[model samples]
Target: SDRKFKEILSKSIHDGHKIYEWLDTDEKLKLTRQLAHSVKLIYYLKLQQQLWQDYYDLGIKDGVWAPRISK
Candidate 1:
């Protein structure tokens, strides 16, 4: 499943508007959710890092941003 998901992402990235041609409705929904989660994670991390750096530049010593994942 992981390999297949990777292939879908790769092809979609290169082919641009071809995801509908490659996946059915259910598959499209699943892939969209996965992609959205990934994008949110990346945005959160980047924003956290920027905020931490801002605090550090302002001379705040305890501005450490540590990420912990819990299932």
Candidate 2:
């Protein structure tokens, strides 16, 4: 999955238009959701990493951002 994700992202960066030929409608729908979820996850992960670094720099031990869970 990681390999596939990297391939898609690399293709988009290098040859954005060519992805149309590689993906069908259904595949596009599924892949869009997959990519969106992955991107959001990576974004928050990076944000968290930066936050941790900032906290470390400030000598703040317990500062963190926690997402809320819903039932």
Identify the candidate with maximal TM-score: 1
Candidate 2, residues 1-71: lDDT per residue as tens digits?
64476466556666756655545466675777687799999999999999987877666445454445699
Candidate 1: tens digits of C-alpha lDDT, residues 1-71? 64466465656587745655556567675877687689989999999999977876665445454445699
Model 2's TM-score against the true structure: 0.48
Error of 1 at 31 (Å): 0.4
The local distance difference test score of each candidate is 0.68, 0.68
TM of each candidate vs. truth: 0.50, 0.48
* Clashing residue pairs found in predicted model 1: none
Error of 1 at 6 (Å): 23
lDDT of 2: 0.68
Position 18, candidate 1: lDDT: 62
Regions more than 4 Å wrong, model 1: 1-24, 60-71
Q: Where is model 1 poorest over a 10-residue stretch in terms of lDDT?
A: 59-68
